[model samples]
Target: MSEASIKRAALYRMVTPEHICPFGLKSRDLLRREGYAVEDHRLRSRAETDAFMAEQQVKTTPQTFIAGERVGGYDDLRRHFGKPVPDPKATSYQPVVAVFGMALAMALAGSWASLGDVLTLRTAEWFVAFSMCILALLKLQDLESFSNMFLGYDLLAQRWVRYAYLYPFGEGLAGVLMAAGALTWISAPVAACIGTIGAISVINAVYVERRALKCACVGGGSKVPLGFVSLTENVMMVAMAGWMAFRTWA
Candidate 1:
């Protein structure tokens, strides 16, 4: 379409001495970006803002109207522009990603500081240990939530609820021992038992039963999905345990 035929938008927002609506500015900018000629209607006082809302039957300021039709508020403008609106209640892998990313970074830093190399056997061990510590910390943050989520798939936890609560402590203890390269007898067995149980539980829930669920790996509060990442964590623990046990015995 030609520039002359571009859509027109009307915006009503608060611009009082004490407050200026940020959404109003964003709406105006978005409208301009989308090739809309905006008619900015500023309400200079609370009374005027209230009056405008009442007249327009809107509960909020920063209302936008496009092509003589009410386009609602800032969120509405985004929808009209075909933007992806964020859902506050939605599940995401961000928490798990962030935790794992940080764990890897810490591992690299520790490796550089101790061994003068970024990639080594020690580095890989540190990565696994650090990841365990971090994941355990997340679970410990809200033990109740973690236990509840864990019980959904963990066979041991389902049979013995206390196991869910004790799991984090066990993970954290094993991680700390492994990270320091101390108490191999204790840490190795702890890691192996938990890892084996976790792997089995996850396989049953995800593959055998085909049950879809949330992961408690990051934390009870996280929305991370139960799948490959969770399985990888268990596998890492099992591998670490095996490595540590072999080193101790050999």
Candidate 2:
């Protein structure tokens, strides 16, 4: 296509000897994907970048201009094209949903492989066990961070801080034992102990106190809110423990 037929955008970004702005590359890629020819302008030093920002009255770099109209920074450029911009502080269940979805898939696959069936009582048990394992794995990734987050809402963790750290290992162990349908004597008590504490904590924090907080059930890094989903995790654990005990003894 000719120059006149092409959509054109001018992007100004910081590209110093020490650093290159990542968002600038993102902006350039977006423009090209949207069929725009980008005029890439590098503010080679901090002085030049500051001057540009001052002139544009903008706070950040990776600014884009289209049709002689300044579209601000990378996020602003996305908005200019009517694209949805991601919010950092947005409450999202995507991570939790993904973990649960994967756990369910694993359960179904395991059932088919072992029993030649996708749906069964064992599959449901395995699904919950797998979910616990995954969730515990997420927590164990950064135990310190998870503990810190858990201490915010957990009653037992607040009183005895070490419980927060040990919680992941206990949950993971319970999950493994439950999945194998072995040593329910050990797994049942572990699951029940943690699950009761977790459920009560969630209810107190989210239901009774009505305080909105991040859930440590998935991980400290997760933005999953402290609410029904969080409660469900604990409830599932408690229910799993009871079911295992009943199956083994009654």
Q: How would you encode candidate 2's per-residue C-alpha lDDT over 61-151 as one tens digit per residue?
A: 9899999998888888788789999899998889889989999999999999999999999899999999999999999999989998999
Worst 10-residue stretch by lDDT in candidate 2?
A: 71-80
Misplaced by over 4 Å in model 2 are: 13-21, 40-59
Give the C-alpha lDDT of model 2: 0.94
Cα distance off (Å), candidate 2, residue 163:
0.4
User: TM-score for every candidate vs. truth?
Assistant: 0.74, 0.86
Query: Which tens-of-lDDT digit does each residue in 46-157 have in candidate 1?
Result: 9999999899898998999877889999998899889988786688888878878998999999999989999988888888999999999999999999999999999999
Clashes of 2: 0
- Superposed Cα RMSD, model 2: 2.7
Q: Provide the lowest-lDDT 10-residue window in model 1.
A: 219-228
Pairs in clash, predicted candidate 1: none
Per TM-score, the best of the predicted structures is: 2
| lDDT of candidate 2 at residue 85, scale 0 to 100 | 95
Clashes of each: 0, 0
